[model samples]
Structure formats: structure tokens, C-alpha cells
Target: MSSIAIKFGIGKSTVSDIVKSKAKLEEFQTEIDDGDCTKKPRVVRKSDFPELDRAVYLWFVHQRCKGTPISGPLLSAKALQLYPRLYPDNPADFKAGTGWLRRFKDRHGVRCLSLQGESLSAAMMDVEPFREKFLKLVEEQGLTRHQMFNCDESGLYWKLMPNKTLVTSREKEAKAFKKPKDRVTIMACANASGSIKLPLLFIHKALNPRCFKHIDKNDLPVHYYAQKSSWMDSYIFKEWFLNRFVPLCRNALREKGLPERALLVLDNSPAHPDIVSNIYRWIDNMSLLATQHYIRYPTHGSGCS
Candidate 1:
């Protein structure tokens, strides 16, 4: 053993350790050969409840494939939800807490990271100044929580499909299929106090979908509009603001005996009409108190609204 260690340029203790771990090393090699393991991790730590952990992992993977954002709390909640079903007979004390979550992440090689955008590049210095200014303006204008509103639009990929899948060694290749690119933009608005939630503005590419052929557009729950790109534009926003939003606010205020005036807080979106120009003077003309524009600071990184 000493001569062999010297020949291989290894310490005698290392050779003895390797001899001791020979069986485990062989078993690991067998696992890699059989395609059960990828040889990424040196040690394989078995879970107490393998089936339960696997179910949670599958659920997590499914959600991720559908582009659903997952957080630590959500994962833990899901584990707790599925635990009872997986181990019906076993009355084990299983709490999916922080420790379990940490182990689960390590076991599945999962890491939390920002997949798309660089939010850290935002000018954080401007944030405090903006908050101060906004608060001061609200105080000076005597804008109550219910009288102030904020609106934003987000896209929903309704026809999203997973781009990746696990395949067996027997299969030559996994066939690719054209994924559906259907999407819609939904615009939602609500007051700071959550007292007033305006009807959603739903935008689609088609003017009249086949499903809604027999139905009346007027009876729809949302303020529906059509755009070629199925996205918010200046024309669509202006129409919704004047026809839908203004009327709804006016009626709600009348019912509650509040003042007709309201302060609409809007982010600097391209779809929003240029406030600097005289094009969108309806805020003042139509008895709406003011349009508070949240401008993104011009910086090296793209500003967030």
C-alpha cells in the first residue's frame, strides 16, 4: 500500500481512505452507467419521504414550465398541501419549514435567480425623492386614499407550453412542435385604499372572437378593445379613459357622495398620451382634479416605473 501510494504520488492515508470507499465509488459508477445519475453530485443523500419530495418537485417543475413564478413560501405551502395525500397511512410529523426548503433546493439543484430583466440597474436614488414629492403633492392637493388611483397593464400568455422535457435513452430525439403564441394584455386599476376597483380593460388582436360571436360586447365584464398587436396603444387608452373610466368614477363618486374630482396616478408608459403636450387636457377639462405622472429618471440603465 505504501509503495502503490508513492508510485501514484498520493499520501498513504489517502490510499487507505480510497480503499475504504471503494465499494461506494463502484456503486456510484454503476449509477452513472445505468443513467440513474449524471455524476454531478459526489454523494447521494436519500430523502425520508422520496415519493412526497418527488411529487412536490414535479409540481414545481410543472408550474415553472407554465411560466408561473414560484417563491419560497409558495413552494413550502405546496409541499404541505401534498404531504397528506402522499403519506396517507404514515402519521409522521412533517413540517415543510425553512430547513426542509433549503434541503429541497439542494436536492433538486434549484436556485433562485432573476431570469429576465436587470432590476438592480434602476436608479434607486430617484426612488426616495419621487416618494417624498408624491407625498407632499398628495398632502397639498388634499387627495384622500380613495380619491387617488393607479393603473398598469400586463401581458398574459394564455397559450404557453413547456419548451423542455425529459426523455428516455431509447428515444433518438425529442421532437419539437410549434408553440402557440397567443397572448392578451389586461389593464387593471384600483384606488390606494382598495375601496374602488375599476373594470378591467382587456385587449385582444381580433375585433370579434368566434367564441363571442353570439354574445354582446356591451354585456361583457371587461372594457374590451382590439389592437393589431393585442397591446395597449395611445388610441385605445384614450378611448377607455374617456368612455369607460371617467363614467365609472363619476357614477361611483355620485353614489358615495364624494367629490367628482379624482387624481389619476399614471406611470410613463408609451401607450399613455404625452402629458407635456396639449393632447390630453381632458384631466383638467373633464373635472378630474389632476393627472399625476410618475416619470422614470433618465439613467444608464432603463428606468422602472
Candidate 2:
């Protein structure tokens, strides 16, 4: 080893390892009865200990589903936490470190990903289908660009994004959302002609918050409503449509000097009470309003962003 190391200008330990590699490399090659051992196949295993890795993966998925905050270091710490409990025989002798973490991530295909729930890719596939339906509806209703209106309810975090919004696949934990966050639901209605914009409804959990102590409620940017969870429901939707939306449309059309005939595009959901069950009642009530509009329902997330 010393002679080989001096001649190759390498360390004696490296020369010894090189000499030992010949048998190890040969062992990795295929052995056939035909005396041919040319192939060297790459093998994939779940982990050095696949059964233990499987348990870890299951635990990871369960915790993630519960919206637990997880990071690389956190996962490594967890592995250490579970090592003794999982392997009772010589548990303290187990090696759970960067090597295990790296292999575990690769095996499970878990990555640190920033997941935003918007940008519904599944909806994009139906854009062409929606266009054809939209055109057919417009022709049936005899509606123009000035008469076309859109209303959508969106979820927002006034303070910061919620930690539950972040998601990941496989045996790793999701990254927690940073910053303080308070959720708010907002509903808005506007015309394509940009002439009419009805009062935007901002849903809050509290009827009166400490933050609004100084600001006048009458001069607020949006019409405020309160609910236990600050969410829109069938009752609120009916009131907005019959009492608020109907009057706003009539006034807006009158201001623009356009005919009181328009289409109200709705954000549709199959399970929703307002857009599904109580929609017929709303349509019947529209006859009393000065503005005669038809309800144009688009599937959940199928509407234009």
C-alpha cells in the first residue's frame, strides 16, 4: 500500500481502499452460468431499513394532513425521537442524521414546496367549453358588454396567510405560513363596461372590531357583514341578491343611461345552498326589480379569474 500510494502520489489509506474495491465492485456485478458478469445494475430500496422507513412515511403523511409545521431539521429531530421507540433492540446505536434525512427525502420524493391554492389548473382545461356556453347564454339573454356583470366571493387573509394553506406530498411535513393572519371573506360585483361597481361586502367574525373604533362605518370602502366564521351563506346571498344587488343594478343602469337589462354571472357550487337550491326563488323575485337580469352560473373555479 505504501509503495502504491507513493507511486500514485495518493494517501496510503486511499491505496488500501482502492485495492479492497476490486472485490466489492465485482460483487455488485451480475453472475451468470454462462461465465458472463458484464452487467452492473442499480438498485433502489425504500431505505436501509424499509419497514422502519414505511412507518416514518405514514407518520409524516398523518401529521401533514393535520397541518403540522415540518422542516428538514424538524424531520431529522423526529427521526431521533422515534428511533428508540421504534427499535427497542440497541435503539441508541441507530444512526439518524443528515445521511438518513437525505436518503429519506429522496426515497419519498418529498420536497419543500410553496403551495398556493389559487391558480386552479383543473379549471383552465374548461376555458374553451365555458366560452362556447357564455356566448350561447349572451345570445339567449340578448346581453351586451355593458349588460354583462360578474360577482365573485374570494377568501383573503387580512393579516397573513394561514399555515393550513401550505401542503406537500409524500413523507415530509409542509412549511408553515409565516406572519400574523386573520381570514376575511369578500364578495364583489362589477360590470365589464367598467361603469358599475356595486358595494363590496366584507365578511368579518366580529360585528365591531377595536380596529374600526376610529373609522366611520358609513364611509367604509366595503359593506361590512358579520358571521360566526366570517363566511358567506345562503341567507346572506339571498339578502344581497334581492335587497342590495337588485337596487344597485337598477341605479347603475340608470346612471349609465343604458337599458335596465343585464346578466348576473354567478360563482356556482353544486353543494352551495344559494346558487343551487334557492336560485329559482331569486330568479322569480328579479321580475319585481326594475333591472331585468338572467342568472349565468359558472362551475366552481370555472369562472374567469
Candidate 3:
């Protein structure tokens, strides 16, 4: 061996060690082959898939776009099933699905289907200053001046809960579920004065204008319907404000002791008729009383109104 190593320009000890290791390995292989303890083929676990993390992110995006409720186990199962279709031969392993989703959610701030209490807290923090300013304005204006009212329409869905419920992590937890297709209209008016009135009518179908049919000359108390594209027609504004909102405002002043020159605020929605016509009419009609009252905050002030 030493003579052969010298001739090949290699160290004799290095060659000998390699030969001895090979012999030992061969002997071990023989012993294993002769024994009943057969070596099992190594299985690639879900964690072995190189692209499992990427697959989980894609799945999450898909579900969010579709407005689907998602969870860790569900996402993992979905990723495993979809991996084969999306990546073919390099599908993600099933076992790593949950871990990938958890990591993805932590890194990206993906919210679950149901909002958590912490979310409400975050929103409150953002709006707290606005609320404080509003309260101060109300205090300065007095109850009559601040007569804040909110008018909006809500959809009453089938099996809707009357109140919000708490959520828990228990399996088979009771969830508030409802049929989305069945819904009814519920228009309501409420004020900071603690007065609330339900609309006299409710529409069984969403788009039916029949609920608004009764809002004619007799019921025009400062018409407050949301502006729609159709209301932008040449004569719609004149017809609505001149015939409706003005008359209602006059009547409200008489009945509610609202100042004759009360300010009327509204959004700058395209559907809104130009303020010039309405202002002219109010000034012409109310004269001196209109001096103290003028529409202020013409843009984005509808909420306060």
C-alpha cells in the first residue's frame, strides 16, 4: 500500500483509511441486509416543502378576496390540497399547513372573519378626539342649537341577532348565522336628545321605492333623502328643495321652535343641487330671520347635521 501510494503521488495513510472505512461500511451493510430490521425509506414531511410558506400566503389572499372565513386548521388543509394543483410535483406537505398560516397572519396582520374586541378599541382610539370635539360643540350650542339627529337605513336580515354576542374558542361554539338573501329595509331617525322614531313603513325588497312613495308634499319635513344619480337631473333639485325641504323646514320651525334662520348642513354630494338656489330661496323667504342662519360646513359635515 505504501509503495502504491508513493507511485501515485498520494499519502499511504490517507488511502489506507479510505479503504478501511469502505470495508467497515460494506460489512455494516451486509449485517443490515441479513437482519430483519430493514431500513425504511425517508418520508418527506410537510415541513420539507420549500415553498410551503409561499403557498400559505397565496391561499390566505385567495380566501380574503372571496370573503371566506378562515382558520388555521382549515387554511393548512386547503394549502395541502391546493399545493398539488398549484405547484404540481412540488406541493407543500400537509403537516406544516397550520404553522405556515399562523406565521403568515402574525407577519401580515390578517384579521380573522369576526372582528375582535381589540379592533373596536383601536377604532375608538382613532375617533376619540373627534368625539371630544363634537361633545364640546354640542355643549356650547345648547340642546336646541345642537339638536343632533342621525337618519339612516338598516337592513333587517333573517335570523339576525337583536344584540351583539361574545365569541369564544370552544369547539362547536354557537355562532350567529343568518340567511343573507332575505333582508328588509328599516329606516330610522334618532337624535342626541334620546328621541328615536322608526320609519312608518318597511320595504320587503331592498330597491322598492314604494317605501318612499308616502314622502310627498304632505310629509316633506326638510327632505333628507340621500342624493342619488337620478336626482341630478335639471329639474329634480328645484322640484325637491323648493317643493319639499323648504316647506318642511318652515313647518319644523313652527312645531319644534327651530330658529327661523336655522343653518342647514348637507354633504357636497354631486347629487346635491348647487347651494346657491336653496340659499337664495331661504333668504328671499325668511328675510331678516335668515341673517343669523346660514348653511355652514358644506362639505363632509353631513354627519354632524
Candidate 4:
């Protein structure tokens, strides 16, 4: 052992230990190699069936479609619950489960590709069909630019735009004097014959009948003005339209000396009691003032906008 160590430049103790271990391992190998040893071929368990894996993947896909973020561990747990016969083993195979899910998603395009609601994508897809219907309606309704006037209420925040340009500290400090509270301005406009009416601008803490009192029977056109308002469950909408909106339209039309065959385009909103009562009374009385020149219903405002 000492001679061997010197030849190999190793310590005698290390050389003896290595030789003894090698000899012991060789003897063990020779014994194992004899008939006493039967080396059955090692068997590899096949991965879970593709169909089961695909089903698990689909489950995750559905959850994700509904805005749920399903991680691999969660999916594996779910699989165990759903298919105990298949996933009865340890959940450490979560990586394999997630891999199957990813494969299924890629193959079938089952993942949601939209950031917005599914309805938004559906609406976008329906645009072309909607346009075709709109054209048909326009023809059937005999709508011309002169006959159709667009009216919409828009809101504006009354404040100087926040300066985007970087300002020195001194400049900001100078302008730090208390700024006025921002105000919301609601304005409505009607356009006809290449002319737009002087916009009706009002600042109200909220939209209500009182806020719209300025619109009386004097500001409307005789022909239909396509006015748009949202559906809010309040009488204010009816009060504004019946008492203020329609009257203003009539008065404006009278002032323009145009005939009263005006159509008011409004969404289906429940009228306030006052407006509903007024409408009922007008209908009962069959009064000329109650007679609408024309009222056109809109399926939607896609083309109108």
C-alpha cells in the first residue's frame, strides 16, 4: 500500500482505503452477477392518460375564462376531487397537469383573448350586421339628414387641464394657491341644415328636473331632433323630456317656421309620473298640441353616433 501510494503520490492511508472499498464493491458485484440475483427489467409507469389530462386542462380553461386565476397546485387538487380514480396519487405531478392544460389551450384556442367583457367582443362582431340592419331601417323609415337632427347631452369638467409640462418647484409653489373646485358642465346641442343651435349649457350638482328647467317650450325645433339620454330610474328624465325637452323642441320648430313633423329619438326609459300623466292626458284629449309629428324608435345608436 505504501509503494502504491508513493507511485500515485497519494497518502498510504488513502490508497489502502480506496483499494479495500474497490475490492469490496467488486466482490459484491460478482455475487450479484451469479444466479442468486434475478434482475427483472425496470418498468416505467406511463403518464396519466391524455384524455384525462385534457379534461383537467379544460377545467382550468373554463375557470380562467371566467376570470379565475387557477394555479397548477389548485388545478391538481381540483383534479383529485373530480377524478379521484385517476388523480389518487400524489399532487407533486402538478407540473405535468399544468403542461397538459397548456397543451389543450394551445391546440383548441380555449383561452380568452379579450381584455374586455365577452359582450364587448360580441358587440364588435355584430357591428357589420347592425350596419346592414341600420341601412335597411333608414330606407324603410325614410330618414334624411334634414328629417333627422342629432341631439346628445355631453358632460365637461370645468378645470384648467393639469399642466403636463414639468414645472419647477417654484412655479408649482406659486400656483399652489387654492384652486376652485372642478365643476361638471352638461350641454345639449341640436343640429339641422348645416347649423347648430347655440348650445344649452348648464352646471348642476346633479341631473334633475330643476336643473333642466331652463329648457322650456322655447328651445326646440319643429322637426324631430334626435335627442339622446341615458336610462336612469328617475322621474327627472321624463320631466325633462315631456315638460322641457318636447316643449323646447316644439317651440324651436315653431320659431324656425318649420312644420311639426319632428321625431324625438330617445331610449326606452320609464317616464316620470308627471310626464306619463301628461302623455295620458294628451292622448285622452287628442289635442293638436299632443299630436306628435313623428316618433322614430332606434334599435341602437351605433350609426346615429
Candidate 5:
């Protein structure tokens, strides 16, 4: 062993360790493909529950192929669920906790990443032409940073529960409860310069929820409204535009000693009405005191930066 270590330009202890692990190295060589024998890893750790590990890894791969997201807790839960079925007669005490999950991921060479959706899709789309056109329009209209604004709405699950939880050793399974579906819609508007932010328009299913029964709706921080679906609609948006938006914008401009003339950027949502395509006609009928121009921005693109 000493002669072999000297020939390989290594320490004698290293050769001794390799000699001790000869059986394991042979086992690894047999497990991998013939072509991959030359690409063997330096270290190979065996799983405590081999069948369970394999089953979990196969299940994870199947889910990922179907575009299903797998969280750490979800993976752990699935492992715990499958263990009993895999070993009905065995008395193995398996708790697929965080430590076990870490090792499992290392064994399978798995990585956790954020799911890509609309934002990533939008990034891939060509928005440069739209940006150039928008810049040109801004320059032609003599619009300042403070005079350009953008508005958008989003849904909120107010009473959503956490995806994970903790349980005692005495309790083998975590308690399950009906997930809440309580929701609301919120709309926000702000200028490019960040000089002004209008009051949020909050929409709920109830005109006066039980929590706000004793309080006046007008006194609330948000400009509250009620709709059956708790979603933004044409009527609600029109009301917000004519009543809330115009007056607030006029006041804001007055305070800044600027003309009550500005441009509003919006998306092509059904709720925004037909003003985007024919804003001049709509503005004429509304007979507003201030001049307001509306621009229909691409929905896939983000808000004005």
C-alpha cells in the first residue's frame, strides 16, 4: 500500500481508505450504466429507506413533468403518506422531516426554483417597439413624469392559510381544516414620478361585511365598494374614474400648482370599458373640468417605470 501510494503521488492513509471502500466502489460501478462507469462520483451515500427514496423521487419527477409545483412540505407529506403503504408489515419509524428532505434532495440532485409565469413570459415577448412608440407619444404630447399615471387591479385572498405547519410527536399527522376562500379586489393608481398615489379602491362581496358593520364605509382607509364576485367591473371602474380619480387628481395638481391636465395609462381589461379605444368621445360626454388622456397599454407588459 505504501509503494502504491508513492507511485500515485499520494499519502499512504488515502490508499488505505480507498482499499477499505473497495467493495462500495465495486457496488457503485455495477449500479450505474456501462458508459457512466468513468464518470463515477467521489462519494456515494446510501439511503436508509431505499424503496421509499426511489418511490418519492419517481413521484417528484412525474409531478415536475406535468408542470406541478412541489414544495418541501408537500414532498415530505407525500413521503409520509407513501411509507405506510410500501411497508405494511414492517415497523420502521420514519419521519420525513427537514433533515431527511435535505438529504433526499442531495441524493436526487434536485433544486428548488421559483415557478415561471406571466412575468417571465412577458419578459420574453418583444416590448421594445411598444416602448419606443410610447416614448415618442410622450415626447409629442409634452407629458412630464408627474403627468403620466398607471392603474391596475389585483385579487387578494384575505384569509388564506399557511401551506405548512408544525405538529407534536404525539400527533403523527397534522390537523387538516377547510381552506378559507374569503377574497377581495384592490385597485391602485399612481404617477410615474411617484409624486401622487390615489386612494385604493377596495371591492368585496358584501356592502358592509360583519367586521365593518359598526364602522362607516366612508371613514375606511380604502374607497370601498361591493360586487357579487368581488371583482372589478365596468361600472365600478367608471365610478372610480369619474368620482374618485378625477377629483383626487385635480386636487393633487392644484396643490402642485400644475395644470389639471394629465395622461392615464391602463390595460385592455374588460372592466376598463371602451375608453381606451375611443377615449375622446367618452371624455367629451363625461364633460370633465380637467383634460385627461387615456392610453391603452399592453396587458403583458409591466406598469410604467
Candidate 6:
């Protein structure tokens, strides 16, 4: 191999690979004595099937741009679909399996990490200031794991199906196939330790639907909040924070032997009001009612959490 590398002026590893295969012309010139000569050529992917691979890459890029969730199986199925369309006469014997998908990702430097939907308009400089403020609040308040909580709102279309499905033979599409928009906005709150999962406040469209005639509201799994529009308004938001959220957080903290105080982190939105109508902010003494009245929200002047 060293001799071959010296003679051909190629790298030793490359020469070594060829030495086991390529022979001195004298040995080849004599006869086809003992060497296997009918092996398939090594596949150099860059030069191999440029059209097919590029289509797959382009599809992935397009999906990412549109914020579509692309899984491994989804890409594999897409590759299979693209093959026949890309190459009509010459159908390549390519298996877009797990091995192929992994190699493709490595080759293209495609990253598969957990994705968070942050505002696209938000700048990099805006993040550090927010982080500093949040940390300062934590330090000043002396908040613990049980006391610190984050609440996020999301819409879930419970009875919806993904747009595409694999079909084996000649199969028919479902009757009146359409993407579902049936949704309910849910407010979920949990602490850093994840020891407690609070009762999810599901805001549904129907105020008094016919379906719940037999079902008891108290016995329901989720804390169902009713609204005609199924949205979080100032009134609904205040009610949730004051009535449901405070008591739950207090109970959770008490169970864990922590402080009654909790830092509820919420995004700055129109639904969150600056002032309560007739009551004083902060230490609102609710002696008439048994419940604690210290459910604090950020004011408009104080701004974002």
C-alpha cells in the first residue's frame, strides 16, 4: 500500500483500498486467474442521483419555511412518492429507509431538535434584557421551585386527523375529506418540579351545550370554562386568576410545605387587566370571604413577564 501510494502520489488509505482491488498490470495482463472483477462501482452521492436527492432536500426546506412538522417517517414516505414522479422511465431501486434517512441528514447537515414557536419578529437583543429581568425578580422574591409557575395557552383540535395517510393498494379517500378547525383554548399551569398538574381550564365555544345534559359538571376531568367565542377576555382572565388559580396554587404550596405566595408568569396580553375595579392592588383583605385575596397580576405600566 505504501509502495502504491509512492508510485501513484495518492493518500495511503486511498492507495490501501485500491491495492486490495487494483493490481500491477503484469498480474492483470497474464490472465483472469483469481481476482473478482465484476463488483458494482462505489456510490458517490454528490454525483450519483442529484435530481432525486435534491427534490427531497427542497421539500424539507419548503416544509420548514412553512412551519410544517416534518418527521422521519414523513420524509421517507415523501421520498418514495417523489421517486416515480421525478423519474418516470427509470425507476431507481432505492430504499428510503431509516438508514438512508439518517445518512441523508448527516450528509446535508440537517438538525433534528426540539422546536419552540417564538415570535419570528422578536430580535436576539430583546431576549437578554427579558432574561435579566426575570432572574432579578426571582432573586428578589426568593421564589422556590414550588412557588415559581408558568402558564401557557394553546388551542387543541381534539377530534382532528393528520392530512396524509399511507395507502397500500388501490384505496379510496375518506368521505368529504377536510381539515378540522374544531378547537378549544386551554390554560395550563405547572411548576418547575412538575410534581403538580393543575386542573386544565378548557374554554369551550358552547356555554350550555346539549351534550352535557346527563354529565355532571363537577365530576368532569377538566375545569371547563364556558364562553360563546371560546376566547380569553379580560373578564374571563381575571375570573380565572382570582377564583381558580390562587386557591389551587396556595393548596399546592401548602401540600408541599412551601410559602402560600406563588409567582404566576403570564405573557403580556390584552386579556390581562391593569387594575381591579373597586379594590386596592396587592394586600386586598377578604375577611368576609374565607379565601385569600392576594392574586396579583402585572399592571400595564409594569409590563411583560
The backbone clash count of each candidate, in order, is 0, 1, 1, 8, 0, 0
> Where in model 2 is the C-alpha error above 4 Å?
1-129, 161-179, 211-216, 270-305
Global lDDT scores for all candidate models? 0.76, 0.65, 0.46, 0.45, 0.75, 0.65
lDDT of 4 by residue, 66-152 (tens): 655445456556655656456667445544356655443343334333243233223345457645754564475554444334444
TM-score of each: 0.54, 0.47, 0.32, 0.34, 0.59, 0.55
Better by TM-score, candidate 3 or 2: 2
**Cα RMSD (angstroms) for every candidate in the order listed:** 17.9, 12.3, 19.2, 19.4, 10.5, 13.7
lDDT of 5 by residue, 202-247 (tens): 9999987899877998898999999999999999998888788877
TM-score of 2: 0.47
Ranking of all candidate structures by their TM-score, best first? 5, 6, 1, 2, 4, 3
Error of 6 at 35 (Å): 36
> Could you tell which candidate, 1 or 3, scores higher by TM-score?
1
TM-score: model 5 vs. ground truth = 0.59
Candidate 1 local lDDT, residue 221: 90
Off by over 4 Å in 6: 1-42, 45-116, 119-121, 172-176, 275-305
lDDT of 5: 0.75
Model 2, CA-based lDDT: 0.65
2 against 4, candidate with superior TM-score: 2
| Cα error, candidate 6, residue 194 (Å) | 1.2
Candidate 3 positional error at 233, Å: 6.6
By lDDT, the better pick of 5 and 6 is: 5
lDDT tens string, model 6, 1-305?
A: 67778988899998666555555433433322432221223322341456877798888889778756677888888888988887787677777888888766654656565555554334456567767766776686677777767776777898798755787676776444677788889989887778877888889998767999988876787778877778877877778778877777777777878756666666556565654322223522211111112233332121110
